[model samples]
Target: MTGRRALRAVQAASGLGGLVALGAASQVWLRVAVPRDRPLPDAALALSGRTVAPLVTALAVAGLAGLVGLFATRGWGRVVLGGLLAIIGAALIAAAVPHAWAPGPAAVDDLLTRPLAGRDPTRAAVATTVPGWPLLAAGGGAVLVAAGLATVARGRRWPGMSSRFEVAGQRAGPPRAAPDGPPADAAVWDALDRGDDPTL
Candidate 1:
């Protein structure tokens, strides 16, 4: 109804959408890039096992919190939701930057047929100097950050429609005095017969 209410609605929708996108991306990355069969670099494996999974779980929780906050009209709830979104975005960026900027051994060696008999090469030696994965991850992270920011902004003016309704009621005021005649409505006519000016 009012601008604030409309904004809250928009923010809620954006936050939910962003959260869903982030979750989907994380799941896809894990399935394709961190599959069980693949021998992840030590660092990559460690991060995926110790850092990324927890972060994803946290982000999902935050998304749910944001949705609840939107409905509850609680200020602190919205803030927490926004903060969660930020955390998720930051985690994505952190994970993506290394992958994008520094090519790992997996980037160069053919995973399908690479021999395991020889000494494993360092990520620096086998890393590809491309900006593909990083750019995609960064872009997605930026969207999430933006979504979080939007949620916080919208929270500032939430429940605006309630205020509008109150103001409208106030403006309508008490009924005006009717002209010296029975009012048109049958209800008013009954009041008039009872020596009461229903308009007043």
Candidate 2:
């Protein structure tokens, strides 16, 4: 594809990936239930991806912000940002992969136990892996990696912010006259006052 089209595609993919990760992080990755005696209600704990892997959420947000930076930057600046995005993507993948595969009891307990310490001194919460959200988060990370790689490879040629504003600013400045003549005033009244023919 052409540079501009490729840039647009990469940006769109990056945005999609960021949104997917954010959505996944916000959703429940695990459901924990504490088994109790007949008198107590089983405490239902919904552990979101953010709680399990905070890095995923943080990196996803960085990726989204980098997407905006891509439009504003070009050349080496864009390459640097792309590299940062790639790092963020890789971190997200690392954070989500383990949880996606097998969120073991210990891992779950270590994260959930502290909060339940005061509520239930003897917490035997069984955590069921939701799996879907983590998988989606990993998928998003993969997409972000692809986008970052593409940007680093080809973003130097992609169009930067429009130069129309710069051109407009130049145009708005005081008009210059031809080197061969005095500055020509376009006002008819000025020509008449100068005892010159307005028609000419």
Candidate 3:
């Protein structure tokens, strides 16, 4: 694809990646058990998940910024930015693995042992598994990385925002109508070019 199209695709992918990461960070990531089976389960935030939510959010924000910058940048700048995006994707992959970082049955035991005032620890099943947000985030990161690669490959040929939005080149409507006169008389500048002056 053309550089301009590649850049557009990258922008779209990066935005999508940011949105996905935001969802994971803002929502519950896990559910822990209680003393006995209860009507509701204990939910855990992304901050308390296997991977830190802030890190994921930060990567996502960077990815989004990269899209904005991609439109403005070319040459090696795009390559460097793309490499950063790749690193973010790698970090996401790493974060999703190595389940040891996640809290296991102990988290449930604590809640069952002592619930806060006005709260009761209902009998819930022990939760030894982590939620799915990390995986989702990782998938988004992967897509973002692909977009970054596209930028690196073809960004130099892409047009800058300023060039596309230039006032001299931009048109908001149909072409302007010519003056109601003969061609030689209508465009005095053209007539002057042919050794004739309209005023003289």
Best lDDT goes to which candidate? Answer: 2
lDDT measured at residue 63 in model 1 versus the true structure, 0 to 100? 51
Q: Supply the global lDDT for candidate 1.
A: 0.50
Poorly placed runs, candidate 2 (over 4 Å):
113-123, 166-200
Say which prediction, candidate 1 or candidate 2, comes out ahead on TM-score.
2
Best of the candidates, TM-score: 2
Please say which candidate is ahead in lDDT: 1 or 3. 3
lDDT of 1 at 58: 54
Over 1-200, each residue of candidate 3 has an lDDT whose tens digit, in order, gives: 77667677788887887677656655555555333233444443223432334577677777778777776776788778877777776675565443324455555454344343323444433544445676777777787778777766766667666543446337455654554665554567875674434453
* CA-lDDT, candidates in order: 0.50, 0.80, 0.61
Model 2 lDDT-worst window of ten: 175-184
Q: Write the per-residue lDDT of candidate 2 for residues 1-200, one digit (tens) a residue.
A: 88889889989999999999999999988788765555667878888888888998998998899889888999999988888888888889888888765466577668864554334446566778888898899888888898888888888989888655345345455654434545356665786675544554
Model 2 residue 94 distance off true place after TM-score fit, in angstroms: 0.6
Query: What tens digits encode model 1's per-residue C-alpha lDDT throughout 1-200?
Result: 77566655556654564455455444323211222222543222212211323444454445555555555554666656666666766665665555445434454343223334333343223332334434554565666676667666665555533433343236445755556875579877887685554776
Clashes of each: 1, 0, 4
- Error in Å for residue 162 of model 2: 1.8
